[model samples]
Target: MPPQTREVVVQKNVPATMRDGTTLFSNVYRPAEGGPYPVLLTRLPYGKDIPSYTTFLDPVRADGSGYIVVVQDVRGRFASGGEFEPFASEYEDGHDTVEWAARLPGADGRVGMFGLSYYGKTQWQAAVTKPPSLLSMVPGITWGNHLNGAQMRGGAYELGTIYSWAVTTIAPDILFRRYRDDPQQLGRKLPELVAAIDTLQAGGGYDVLPLTKLPDPDGLTPFVREGFERGVDDGWWEQLNIDGRYGNVSAVTLHIGGWYDIFLGETLRQYAAMKEVAERRGTAPPRLLVGPWTHGNFGSTLGELDFGIGSSGILLNYRGDLADYHLRFFDATLKGREEALADRPPVEVFVMGENRWRGYEEWPPPGAREEVWHLSGGGSLTREAPSGEPDAYDYDPKDPVPTLGGSILMPQIYRAGARDQSPNEERPDVLCYTSRPLEHDYTVLGPVWVRLFAASSAPDTDFVARLVDVHPDGRAIGIADGIIRASARESYPEPGVISPTAPSPIKPGEVYEYRIDLWATGNTFRAGHRIRLEVTSSSFPRWDRNLNTGESGARSSRTEVAHQRIFHDPDHPSSLTLTTVEG
Candidate 1:
């Protein structure tokens, strides 16, 4: 049984000063009867009082559990004071806030942090500062670098997610300030502004030729235009990148990721990096928990499928609910309780298909082997490479492939997670290569990628690959998918480069080896399930359409159709690399 806690005290609009004299506001939730309790700090641009469905950390509940919870509004939002430059100023602001939280009236010296998405990023920013009071952190569904996860991905702008975010989320913050003096007027205007943005988004305005002309001419969100203009990954990206700052984090880190989350790859990368950091310093490796969830929806149902009751974070039998799991982790890390630390595995993963939670010592669980399945003629995916002429498809930029379901972060309009891909797969632009039914249970546990030796009629184009699990009823549920702009090939330096946004045009009608990162997944393909691979040049509205005529870097609405070729002969062996887990 849990210990009886004291009455909760909720303080509103508490101030914490940064080094630059900017004051950030936080709501402090503390036990009214406790002497001093450990601190859990969550700093985010979202209002401190508002509950985030993603993180789902209730400060009131944490306070009742005998901890002082500090939920703060970061600089330039709500009660905080400063110019709102996203990703910038977080390190310093988070550092100052942590130090301040440590000395609060009912706070112990130790401080831990937990939140999802941007809130999770604040924890990393604070950890990088190496604040003396910082002890542990649980950063969920966030990224190691902004370019890879937040802004752009695989040399393409995250049009749907970022643009919608600018219009819906950030634009409202700006509106709040514009009408703060007249709350009544602001209240009426906010809904109208949202409705306007919604109309634009749902009316196929996102498919407009030039992406630069987005957020409409009325200035809903100018930031969206800034993202389109800065195609090259240059100095602006360097300022927000926290790749080299991992070593500075002294806190024991726990990373939480969703298989279908937009930042899945980035989340895994950070976990591996921090685990290596701990090994180098002779400390315990970090923990990782990956669910079969979307960005924030940690429920049993995702898209058209349900993984039963055990799938939801709210029903995890291992450690009560998600909140209880967090509390136990904090208690063990912050207070160093022996009983709380007992028998906890370093890694926990929810394997789809089989729909079961499994524990492991590390990610990519040891003994996972790379199994290569070759793409062949007659729209077949098999182990043998067939000698045949390449498959051809006409890719028109105007009528590119549509996004069915997978990992995407558009406004509420775009659905994510596993969904039937029949609608999109039926398109002529999407070339389907399906495999025979599996003879035995096959489990893929790590990164998935496809190597294609293909030629294009244009100087630049795009190659999109998707892995689907075909059910007996012909439902092609998308498991993983990725895209690569032909121009950004090999642009990254050895051992590093955040998704390489620089354009390096390819010669027309030239065959080049393109590796499409399909990201990571943990799924057991039971016997009789067929594996399907769809090759396409676009996944519309999810990614900006890649105009085949290579001049996308400049402001040109001109587009050209390209003849795409996929080779699967012995000389040019196109294959899918699946990290198959051993039974």
Candidate 2:
């Protein structure tokens, strides 16, 4: 790090008016050096100075990072005014914030947004507003799909992570009577919080953490209470998804994500959707970069195991590349510096394990192939085409097999391809389908979907599929995973139901085709790295268990195990569809 020109930092109070007359206050980071600079703003509910990395950014220091930085206390969090509702007011305030920041004296009149977690979600909503001054964004490891995917995945709710996220991350400051400027004050208050918990348990009417259970696991966030009150996938969830409007994006996007990141799937999904729309409309798409990092892998390893060891062990120059890309992208997209970045590819993926960068004309590469591995007899995952008898096993929901590991994640589950479903084989509830390790380096890009043509004994059931990379040392690391609730089989976006009562109508003799979207990943499983696919009915704790007999199970009520089975015969060609890149 050498000496460089430094910008003067100054702070200001910027006002963002909500749809109603309420005003949200923000602390702006502007260059005291004067007239107009590019603006990189993050309007977060977290207090303006929650020290991140080495030193957290205050208005002056934050805006000093070569641009005007603005951090706001969303609605009721800090110095801001108005009742705090989760993501409810952000979309509107976000639009107002962008318009407000661009007009600031030293602002370059172009806005670029970037941040982590909630900071990430802000980009999702803000981009949709399409403010004239808003230019580009680099949404790091954030959820592209809200409700079901962010907090809930495949009808399964995350208890530890989500609750912790709410308490530590999303809880409005007013709830704890805490202030944002106190970095360690929140942690210090934990003791008092414990005491508060004790007081509430001892008959205090003021219950601090108020989270209600929704019929669907996706509806658990405090911000999403508006949706839970309505009890459906109303406009709230859809507002976060840019699926249909990908074609409208005029700004350059640099998506940063990791294999162990819970939001990795959505990150890839947004990129792919954006490209899909661009292709359909015959326009250029957003740029993507898949790094070998974790949920917070901005400047670290893939997991606890350091991928970079020794001189050769150095991971990619992530921070350097990010700053470089941001500068160049701002020039290209916001400043009309077209020729400056004419050579940049639409997609640049970092292949883990191999640890190198590769450019692609399009995602998945032009001729990337697919590997079809059929499940075989006695716990073998073979690439050999199947032409024989069906292999069957009973899946008991009550004694359901445990979910080993996979890509669908929370910050807690931070390992890449680090899972083995073999242990579950001892139980009759799980089904394992695998393939031989590669003889050479190979890449699997895009979605790893599973199409199962089978029948469930229970009228309503859910199917889960996991993609794993088995090492020679017997370490089964999870790569990607996806699941679907059976009753909702026919519909794509809507919820479906299956009765658990005795002798349900859609049963035993019938066959159904269930498509489990396993999301996407960019990994290099070296030679001798075996590919394994684990299919099971339940991943407890990670997912709310499916009670057999298709009965209505209460959120707080007792659990009921299911009796499950898988049939892979000539009549039922149950198989996995992988988007493989020939390395």
TM-score list, all predictions = 0.95, 0.81
Off by over 4 Å in 2: 5-7, 12-14, 53-66, 158-161, 172-174, 177-236, 276-284, 309-321, 338-344, 387-405, 408-428, 493-509, 549-558
Clash pairs, candidate 1, are none
lDDT of 2 by residue, 497-583 (tens): 211111223475467777776766677788988887778776654555555445433322334444455556556556777777766
How does residue 202 of candidate 1 score in lDDT? 78
In TM-score terms, candidate 2 sits at: 0.81
> Residue 18, candidate 1: how far off, in angstroms?
1.1
Best by TM-score: 1
CA lDDT scores, all candidates in order: 0.82, 0.60
Worst 10 contiguous positions by lDDT, candidate 2 = 494-503
Candidate 1 TM-score to native: 0.95
